[model samples]
Target: MHTPTIGDSVDVLDTPSMVVDVSIMDQNIAKMMKRFEDTRKHVRPHLKTVKSPLLAQRLLNAGARGCCVAKVSEAEVMAAAGITDLLITTEIIGTVKIGRLIDLVMKYPTVKVVVDSIYGANELNLAMQQFAPGMKLQVLVEINVGQNRTGIAPGSEAVGLAKHVGGLKHLRLVGVQGYEGHLQHLAKDERVRLCRTAMEKLSATVQQIKDEGLTLDIVTTGGTGTCEICAEFDCVTEVQPGSFVFMDAAYRNAIGTTYGNALSILSTVISRPATDRAVIDAGLKSLSNDSGNAEPKAYSSMRYRPAGDEHGILEWHDLDLRLDIGTRLELIPSHIDTTVNLFDVYYGIRNGIIEAIWPVSARGKVQ
Candidate 1:
């Protein structure tokens, strides 16, 4: 809620805050969308990274088909914010979550949920019939294509689930989602080879479902790492790439440094522990250490090491420049999604001046 006014200098903002370069972010969005402009595929940017509805609307305005959320609560927040079309990429089970899903469908007609089992489908169908009669929820069968996470097998298992969903009166089998999450961070050639194999499995599943007299309106898949290859596949109808808007060090290593580093933690040098080391105010609470430690921007010789909850150690090697006290340093996060959840608002910067303050509205809505 502490937002800086327009035209404020980035230095004037508080330390340990998240700031986004608006121009760079816009370019990233536009570039990703343009990659799919000529193809039949569309870009459905996931909101799990940038949890702000304002940013989601910006993506939609830039020609995104819709948005994807990881949980039902996230979908609820987006739907309440007037994002009509949304897809909850995770499966929703249990009675309470099922009721919430039904409520969400009642509120937003275009809402969709992924199902990996017939039990989940039946539970959702029964909930819809009891809570919101006459409302049909769009459902997608999640195929476990390489990522041994929360999806069924691609061939017969996927076809069986799709058939089960098709038989439900309150559930409509609209599409199938086969995410190659395990192959997202591989090198380009290996990533493409593995993704092609997975896509072939999913494509065969799509054909099998079609052979069963079922029409799949969508075949949603892919992330920022394999978006280009996935888009080229004739069977993929849409690509959901979230982290391209805010390129992090981990993704930069896997996908190459094509997009700008739009997100960074603005921190102040609080202590000079030694001649070869310094301490920053930001730590595990301010940034995410899930992928790896945050990298100091433009300081190639310096390395970041997490000290404690509120401290970070920065060690330098053969560096003549000294990080004196009160020096401001921008740390590029290692993982954009988890790092974004650590902050409440993003100080939008353009040309070294704060242009807007956008809240992370969907932050902590991870039910």
Candidate 2:
């Protein structure tokens, strides 16, 4: 299909740009909303996937309770877009970062953040006390739900951290967020079992906090891989799945999501380096190598390898190659989130002429 036409045509746009199928994106959003229809869980979709406030608005319209961003800067962009309710899933660190977090809360009045350590909670408390003393920051106790990346131990230690953050002057313990990051792509039965096992810790933590006379409002967990499994857990009140909205190569190959390949890097054939090898415009710069390099999914038989910065070498001479000079090809990125930040705006399309240009509003929100 061609790119949907808005005002400008697709041919005039820059190469190696991110092009999204708006219709496909809607379908993806609808599919996720449908999953949460009869369930009690809230779909606080991870905005880190698109990093676009425009897309986040669409997500809200499509039945998301709010958006979950990884950083305070991302929350700022979404708040600027008029999205008042937001959850910062990452651990808010440093005076500078906490200062920004307090600023965001003061600005939006509905922004929340996760804190796993007493040090982080204390820092936030100090920042709020010094600056926005009246601002109330909702804090989610992040438990180690098999990711082991951040978060405290799931049982009593989690309760201790929650109690500490709760007793803080400015920070209020709103809920618990446990991410099953490691279970995102596990084999089906194993993924379910591991996610359940992880939630067991999270559920116990929630109970322990409740036993201490604390209000446990939110018990959020899950990613695209184990969303269904997480939904079944009685403790989990919400899920923060980012990749479901835009299935990347790793997720598509991992979870078998029904969402089509909506996000693609339209690359042009730059050079045929050798008879056994070819090169394209997209590389480590345009796409991402987080999950591994992008593979030629449509052309699975072809061996797609990255040569360097802006070059993707393809060893696909065999199997009747369709690539030629100036031939535009769509590449599925290895990681959707990183690849999306590589562009300024997404060419939102329907039937493909370039329906709209939506900026990546929260791109590079590393702080």
Candidate 3:
């Protein structure tokens, strides 16, 4: 299929293309920034959702402190695009990845990573010693508040890891990261309460580190669901909410935020099998199926169901709204991160016209 130019209308684009409304995205960014403007906390939006360098730079220009990536390759891509002040939210395990991390530290002055184990910290320190001697790699000790993921317990174990990383000459302990991943999808009241509990544990860990004469600069946590709650806490110096840039169905159902859904899969109706069923060109390959099927946006009664890798079935009870062979429909994906990774380019639309075609720069950089 031929690619559409910037001046082309979104209706002329190919089927199953990832589309982003630039105006709505700008509103989302402004809303997120305004949420923390009254507080002391800052926004460091995560790049895992929208992997485009242009979007990352846009977020930085909109008053975001920096960006966070899930892997070293994502950080490398961001660094090469002239984006500094990046944090690799996940730990770099092997020697090869640690070498890449060291290179990033040498190239970008403010590259940081999360360290949850002493072995990982020592290995990273040793690797940095060989590659970039005298250069300090900033580190944040990850505390497992409730996620039970890659973090130590929030009390002495966290403090002990901080001390270990602090003792290393090549690694500088910056702060702690305690992500409430499990509580992000809960209802409003329960989520806020559990988030407060998690923040309290993280704050206690910070105090433990401070009592040992260690300086903790940044206390980062929260996602799109709990950005407001995390901002209210004075201890959380930075918030890492990734999915706000492109709101998904899952996040929309969980949080009460006013952020609009700026992302959608523009699919064309290819077949009308029956009176009540229609099929689109986008399916599992175009939209993410991890969080159930994508939601139909145009018709209220239409229900989206994944048919296969290249087709989606839409069932509707209304007969007045007809879906012809060439009719185009917009679908709000359940998960934006995985859905975005399936496409190479994002058709940026504003006022029904294609404004720009942004490449998903860090799309497959899941190292």
Candidate 4:
């Protein structure tokens, strides 16, 4: 645990490099781990948000049960890093990817996946047919918990799909996964209520399957915003939260949480051609603006304006600022997930000096 003192001579290497203060990142991880310390529900954090094997290792060190990724390739990277337990939490939607899934299972041997439909289950079944006998793929039935994005509808339809997937030769329905993504960012009370309602829907489906003489083991759901609420539900056996480890301005503004800001991009001021404005080297390509807000600055009046492809214009009307051309400024990202995807490596800094560099291992593992 290193503290950066005032006037410490830490060099800003590049114009638009992504940086993580290691001290802050450890604090963030500890805070989230504390939230799950006494709870019975396990924390299987989604690694899709960070997409870094190093970050995943940090979360595992902080008591994460395992990691949940969006793609097979992301799981492969984590598997190579010695993370044996993984849950692919998205609707794996192709035949080509099933081969990759087979390869991952062969390599790690302790992997599980979530699927919503009989079609996907059949594809997985076909892929695993060539494997050793009695070697089964654990599949979790994904229920449509109000998001309507994916997953089968809760009830008999969901139970039927689970039964079909379970009855398949090489696949077994181990549990159910429902992500209440729509309610994660709502107001606290509303988020709690809506997420509970969605989980209740999923829970009922799980019970229906159990009534059919089938045993369900794991029930996973929730994200950073509704982790506390989700953990309270009796049916939810585990919580899959990712952004809590490295929250951005959007989540902070939504929940008013005190989690330490772990991720930031350090950019250098390149132009100060005018008195009331300054320009930085990072622009739209480096940071995500989908949240429709500029990076909040410590000073209230200094607003960030997008000038061009490679420049961020700072609009400050009153002060006669005297920042040098090589001044370094930290920019908070609007969206942590997409912003992280833009960078290749994150410079982990401690006490204002680079301690380590970790590559974004799953940066382009889209499929």
Candidate 5:
């Protein structure tokens, strides 16, 4: 029942806590906005990374056009917090989710969603008709630009789907969403080259939809790695770069340090069993490892291996440090999205003092 209050020193927080340097995070956002200033696109940062409606508002205040959520459940949380300008990036199907979406839109009419299949679009359209009669749901046709994940094929397939959505009385086709997720972690040259190709296909598809006299007002796409390239492309109305706000080790390796690592998992050294090895209290449950193991911020020369759900083993082969029990160190997550989901709150710090404590509002909204 302890509440973390502002103005307290960050050291008062317990170890293995998720912390963010607000100054660095602000700089990251500023740098990202600068990159898109000269381009013909707006920023609609993806909410799957930060997951906090408070953070979403910060982005909106920082000149973002809107925000993107990966699920209808996530969209619900954001909309509840007055972030109605949301574009749910995933397809919403199933009667349960469609029912929820209908309820959500009844209150916040500005919420938009993406549809990859005609079945999903038709299902949503039917729900809108049944639940909210005479209401039109704004939707974007998702094109599989390169992710090969949840989108229709780019060229003719996208046009066909857009046309199909236009015919639905309860569904309105607004735009297209094509995320270059695969290129988000590639090398600079390779990322740029492949991202252009993906954007080319997406742009052409958007033009084709427009040429068919469809209502294609939005072409939402891109990620932190390819947001700049995506913004420079033709017909791209906005970019959805999520991870740039709190840069992770994986993105850092790919895109370099355009955005600083603003977040970390602070852990305490529990046991210095050996001269070269130390045990800490952060592990798989605290940090994500799907992308790679989290890196020790100050102990970059050391290798970190999760011992179990509660402990991490650190071994030093090159750099020697004064290691002792109760020593606290912060770890930069390899994947920010999954790691942030593991924590309930983010301790926002500035000059080693806590300035804010934001709840992860949409943490488990994976539906």
Candidate 6:
């Protein structure tokens, strides 16, 4: 297949090409960042969704204080692109990962991490002392604020963890990260109520840490669904909302298009096997269905289901129109993050023209 170039029409792209509506994506990024412009909180978009150094730089250029990556390997790629300010939201363990993190952090001190246990903190601190001696790694005590994920118990246990990290010569207790991930896709009313409770737990821990004379420079937490309410809280100094940049089917269904769906999988129909059903070149390997099946960009009655790794069956609820074998279509992914990881590059489009081509530089950087 011939490769697409700048100024080429999106129509020239091959099947299952992941493309971004550049105008919509730019607007999405601007809207999300502008939400915090008048507030004390800063927008530190999480790069886990858009795993591209090019896209990450776009967020930074739009007034983001920094960006967050889910893994250390991702931080390396972003830093190599001259984006050093980062926060690794996951706990880093094992000698191999700690070593990689140490090397990365030694060069880029703005890199931060979250530690849920004293053991993890100790191992990280010990590794730094041996390798990058005399330099403290900024750390956040991950608080379990209703997510039941990887975080220290809120209140006393959280305070204890923060205190221990602060006392360490090679570690600095800079903040607390208690992500309400479970509530990101919940109903709005319930999400607000539960987010309030989660913030309370996080705040109490911050208070306790402050009482012990520990530094809490960053109290960061929030996702696309709850960032609005989270920003209103005095406890939250920053919000990490990544998915808003490329709103997916799941987010659109839940959030009602507060941010436009800027990404889609461009596919071509290969077989019209039945009167009401056709097969496309995109499937589980192209668009993820963990949240639910992807939706066709148009044709409201069209329904899509993965037939296999590289094929998807599209059926219509009402046989209003027949799709030809060579017909091209766009599919909005149900889950943006996983779907983005499936593509190697995003053909940025504007008014049907390929305006830019960005490599998914950190596509598989899940270390």
In angstroms, the error of model 1 at 245 is 0.5
The residue-by-residue lDDT of candidate 6 on 1-367, one tens digit each, is 7789999988899889999999999999899888888999999999999999898989999999999999999999999998899999999999999999999998999999999999999999999899988799999999999999899999899888988998898998889998999999888899999999888888888888899987788999999999888886788899998999999999999878889999999999999988899999998999989999999998888999999999999998676697999999999999999999998999999999999999999998898
On the 0 to 100 scale, the lDDT of residue 351 in model 3 is 94
Tens digits of per-residue lDDT, candidate 3, 166-243, equal: 999888999889899898889989999999998889888888899999999999999988878877777789999999
User: Any idea what lDDT model 2 has?
Assistant: 0.83
Residue-level lDDT tens digits of model 4 in 1-367? 3333333334735658888888888887888888889989889999988898888888998899988998888898889988879999887767678878888887776799998888888888887887634579888999998999988999999999989987999987889998888887798889888988887898788889999988788899988898788787788889998887778888887887667667887887888888777888888888888885457445466778667767888777667666678788887787788888988988888888777788898898888
lDDT of prediction 4: 0.82
351 Cα displacement, candidate 1 (Å): 1.1
Clashes of 1: 0
lDDT of each: 0.91, 0.83, 0.90, 0.82, 0.91, 0.92
Between candidates 4 and 5, name the one with more favorable lDDT. Answer: 5
Which candidate do you rate higher for TM-score, 4 or 5? 5
Q: After superposition, how far is residue 177 of candidate 4 from its true place, in Å?
A: 0.5
Error of 2 at 239 (Å): 0.6
How much does each candidate deviate from the true structure in C-alpha RMSD? 1.2, 2.4, 1.1, 3.3, 1.2, 0.9
- Per lDDT, the best of the predicted structures is 6
Return the candidate ranking by lDDT, descending: 6, 5, 1, 3, 2, 4
Runs with alpha carbons beyond 4 Å of true place in candidate 6: none
TM-score of 6: 0.99
Specify the poorest-scoring 10-residue window by lDDT in model 5.
317-326
Superposition error at 181 for model 4 (Å): 0.9
206: Cα error in model 1, Å:
0.3
Query: Candidate 4 has which clashing residue pairs, if any?
Result: none
Residue-level lDDT tens digits of model 1 in 1-367: 5557888888779889899999999999999998889898989999999999999999999999999999999988889998879989999999988878887788788999899998889999889888887888899999998899989998888899999999999888999999988998898889999999988888899999999999999899999998888777788899998999999988997788788889999998999978899999999998889899999997988899888989999998766778899999899999999999989999999899999898999999899
Candidate 1 runs further than 4 Å off? 1-3
- Per-prediction TM-score, please? 0.98, 0.95, 0.98, 0.93, 0.98, 0.99
